[model samples]
Every structure is written in C-alpha cells, then in structure tokens.
Target: MSKRRIYWTLQIIGWSVLIMFEYVPYVLEYGFDWDNFYNALINIVLGIILTHTYRLVIRKWNWSSLPLPSLGFRVVVSALVLGLIMALINQPLDRHTLEQNLLDQPLVFWGYVLSWWKSLLAWMLSYTVYHYLEQTRLADYEKIMLTMSMREAEAKVLRSQLNPHFTFNALNSIRALVYEDPAKAQIGITQLSNILRNSLLADRRKTVDLQEELRTVEDYLELEKVRYEDRLQYKILADPHTVYWQVPPMMLQTLVENGIKHGVAKEMGGGFVELSSEIVDDVLLIIIRNSGRLTSTESTSSESGGVGLKNTAERLSVLYGKGASFRIFQEDEKTVRSEVRVPTMSENPVISAKEIRSF
Candidate 1:
C-alpha cells in the first residue's frame, strides 16, 4: 500500500475500535461501567501502538508502486495483528473489571470483541476508497510535470536550430560581398570572423552580457553596410546602466536582421534602422525599428517574414515562460518596430576578458 493508504487504514481501525468498545458495552449494560472507562484508555494506548506499527511498515516496504493485491494483503494482515494485540490487552482488563464487582462474564467477551472488529472493518474499507481517489490526484500531478518538461526540451532544440540557420544566412551575405567588392569583402570577412568566434563561444552559454550581444549586432550591421553601402543606415542607443544586463545570445541580433531584411532592404529610396535599449521598471526592453511600407508577400521566408519572430517567441517562452515579452507592429506608416522585454539581470562588471574582447 502507499504510505497515505496505510496511514489512513490504521487511523480508521484505531478510531473504529475506540468508538465500538466504549459505546456498545455501555448500551448493553444500560448504565455507565468501569469496562467503558477501561476500554477508552485501552483504545488510546492501542492507537499509539498501531501508529508506530504503521510507520515501521511504511519504512520497510518502500511502497511507491505497490499493487492492489499487495495493498489488500497488507490491510488484512495489519487488522489481524492489531486485533490480536487488542485481544491480549482486553483479556486481563476484562477480568480485573469483573473482579472489582463489575457484572461482566468472560463467556460473552469474544462476541463483544467480534462486534468491534466488524466496525473496524467498515471504517478501513471507507478509508481505502478515499485514499484511492487521493492517489489518482497525485498521479495526475506527476504526469503534468513530465509533459511540461518535454515541451521545454522541444523548445530548446528549436532555439538551437534557429541560431545556426541565422548564422549560415549571415555568413552567406559576407560570401556574396567577397566577389562583388574585394576591398569591402576583406573587411566583411574580418567582421564575419570576429562575429563567428563570439557566436561559437556564446553558443555554450544560456545568456551573454547585453554589451557583448550588441557588439556582435554592430559587427553584423557593419558587414551589411559594406554590401548595401548608402542604401542602409543604422544607429544604436542604450541606457548606460543597463548595458551589462544578460540576455540570450543573438536574440536582439535576429530582431535587427529581421528589421533590415523585411523593412530597410526592400526600400528603394534607402532607409534608417535603429536599435535601442532601456530599463523600464525591473525589465530590460530592447527595441529595433526600421522605415518600410507595411506589406506581406507569400515569397517572404518565415525566418525573416515570420519564422524568426516565431523562433524568438519560442526562445523567450523557454527562457522565461510568460515573464518575458516580444511584439512586432507598425508604429506608423513609414516605420515598423519589434520590441522585446526580459527580466533585467543585476550588472556583473567582471564577466570575462574573452567576453569583453567580443566588444
């Protein structure tokens, strides 16, 4: 039996014995008697004894996965043992009560004991039913916890996939610049190399300092600038105090890339993209905004069109569940904005020299 089942079983048996032994004899004799008083004390002593017995049983069994037949056997065995002990104590007490001028014969003592045993059986059965329901509830709770863990693992895998996909695309952009403009290509390659090194290092960590992540985005933008020339313009603003905050690596970088691809890249007249961060209440808010017309085409990939945003949402869900926020919307006709809010981390000024080198 489960510990809970065994506990309640013993409780029911003890209480049933108490109620039956004390109340029934008083009614049979039609008056109060020493036997009634003696049985009450016997019940109290027996209750304590049985409680200790129950504890020993639980300790010895390790009954996490006990079967119904085993539980039934335990119930029967415990009742038998408890009844024998009660009977032994009852024998001497009954004789003492009669010798003290109490009119009770030894002939009916067995019958009286059987009456109380039947009551105890009824109580034990009722307790078993209640405990069965409680066990079901506990089983349900464990299943829910397991399901939630599986979902979190799946989200973590998807986030892992997204980081590599974004990196490959970024490297491809640098590769295109290599042949189109050799001088700019050399600088692009160098910037890509630095970004790649930092990305590889950050991959092993769940979070990196916001300053390091911003530096990577800056390098990525610099490489893009070489390709787009005057067609792309960008700026960054950050709250000085919040610069050392920790966030998932490449989180903001992905958002910035989305802004450039979907907004700035599509504009013929050229456009400005801005990245900014601030601490609002206890939250660190990062916003990426760009100038572009509001339109959606079927050809736009989910990564840039919607996939990247979905991936970002999934990562935030894994890292912070509902505590973090991500949003994309049109601020006005000529501007589109993506904003994220995550719990702010206390500044840690001395992360690592290698981390600082990324900046």
Candidate 2:
C-alpha cells in the first residue's frame, strides 16, 4: 500500500486499540456504561487528531534532518506537552460526565500524564527513526550512481583521445606511400577506411568481441605495411577459445600501432611486432612483443607511445578498476613486451583448450 494509506490505517488502529485497552476493562467492571464508552470514544478521536497534527508540524519543520540530540529533546518536549493536553481534557470530561474527581488526586492525574507520555514518545521515536533510515539509504544510493556516471564519462573522454591520435598516425603512414607507390597507397586508403568504419561503430559500444577487434588490427597492420614494406614483419596469434571474449574497442589496434611506431620505425633493421592472446584461469591475457627497449622513464611518460600507452592504461582502470592490468617492460636486450590481463565477460563462450591460431 502507499505510504499515505499505511499511515492513516496505522494511526486509526493504534489510537483505537490503546483507548479500547482502558475502556474494555472498565466496561467489564461496570456492565457496559454508554457514558464511559462515549468518553473513551472522545479520547480516541482527540488522540488521533493531536498526533496527526504533530506529524504535520514535524514534516513542515523537517525535524528528521535534525541532529540526534536536538531531535531527542524536541521529541521528549512534544510528548510531555501532548501528555499534559490529554490529561487536562480527559480529567475535565471525566469529572463532568462520570462525577469522578481525578484532579483532586495529584497521583491519579500524573499517572494519566505519564501513561500518555510513554505512548506518545514511542510513536514519535518510531516515526523519526524510520524516516532517518530511509533518508540514509537514499543518500548512499545516489552517491554510488554519481560515482558510476563520472567513471563512464571519463572512459568516453579517454576513448575520444585515442581516436584522433590513431587517425593521425594512420594518415601519416598512408601519406608516405602516396608518392612512392600510388597503387599501394590506394589500397592503404581502403584499409584505413575499413579501420575507421569499424572504429566509428565501436565508439557506440564500450567493448567488442576479440575476433572483430582483431580484424580492425589486421587492417591497420596492412596499412602500416604499405609504408614500411619488407622492413616491417609482424605476427598475430590467438587461442581459439578466447576469440569470442570481449575487449575494449580499438584497444588491440592501439597497442599494435604503438609497437610499430616505437619499435620497428626507430630500428635500423626493421623490427617485428608480435601480438598474442590466451585464456588463463578465466582471464584474457594479451601480450605484444616488439623489437624495442623501454627505459624506466619511457614506460610511464607521455613520450613512451605518444598517449597510446597512457590512454590504454586509463581506459582499463576506468572499466575494470583493479580487475584489469596493463604494463610495458623490456623482455630482452632488443624486445619490449606490452602485457594486458582482463577478466572475461560473462557473455563469453565457455572456453575449452584449443590450438592457438597464427596469422
């Protein structure tokens, strides 16, 4: 039921029950006196009205937001005041209707006040504590939602940075082939177009299947090969079981491009870039071995892969937090290895041990 309906139901039931507890015993003792029953009815009506009015006042002043000490003080004071009002009204009514001199006995008058005080205090505390807990739960939910939104925005901004940087490097590779080999340049343009189209579609999604991402990476490698020719040699390997796993879009291509740009392009003898993926303990492990050395400063600095490595790390952090990892380190005197490990998505196919594919 709605809160308003629930509040009204409980208010009526609670007042009726409390009043009946006193009246029913008196009725049993005095043989159903209508005058006393009428008195009990008036008391019940007054109790509901006074408590409901107190509810309105509490809400109007937003008393639920008050500190515990201040709210406790207000609750105690309000209950005492309400108890006095109830006693004053009840004593006069009982004296006039039943010829009872309740006020003549201070103990009897104070007993009524104390009983009412206990009941009113219980009601106020119940209401206050419930609303306070509800407010705390809502605040916690909003904080979590805000944190998720900020992370999503940051991931999108990081992805945006990667796109333009990638396009610039791809265009430069095609430019080198334009005058030297117009025919190859034409093919390079087509490959670049395909890669760009895939990237545009990938932008609309947070991740894509590893199989689809590999196609984009292959196209990018083809375009780079047009510029480097026989000087650039590369290989791609993937475990068949892991091909269906999901990874951040364009991520693999960025790593491959980074390998070629920093590894092969700088070497006197054109170097090799090797990309590989395997599933180990339900995690997708991707490793790229390139013919280059990474200095300590280059591994963490912007100069390492020209924002490519830095962007990759940030995107992984945003998407997976500590569940994913990326690092580049020198594997040998002439080879640098860039490694990434990501937890497999829930939608990934059941993995089975299979032979790795090479292309």
- Candidate that scores best on TM-score: 2
Per-candidate local distance difference test: 0.69, 0.81
Give the range of the ten consecutive residues with the poorest summed lDDT in model 2. 350-359
The residue-by-residue lDDT of candidate 2 on 1-359, one tens digit each, is 66778888888899899999988888888888878889998988999898888888877897877898998899999999999898788765544532454535668777889999999889878877877676665566666667667977887887776777678778988998878889988888898898888778766888889999988898888878877888899899999998998799999898888888778888998999889999888899999998876755356466644467887888788777787899988899999999999885422223323422210
Listing every candidate in turn, what is its Cα RMSD in Å to the true structure after a full C-alpha superposition? 10.5, 8.5
Model 2 ranges off by over 4 Å: 1-9, 35-60, 93-107, 179-183, 303-306, 345-359
What TM-score goes with each of the models? 0.63, 0.83
Model 1: per-residue Cα lDDT over 156-213, one tens digit each? 5655655665577677778777667889778877878877777676546667888998
- Scored by Cα lDDT, where does model 2 land? 0.81
- Clashing pairs for model 1 are 302-307, 303-308
TM-score (C-alpha) between model 2 and the true structure = 0.83
Model 1 per-residue lDDT at 210 = 88
lDDT of 1: 0.69
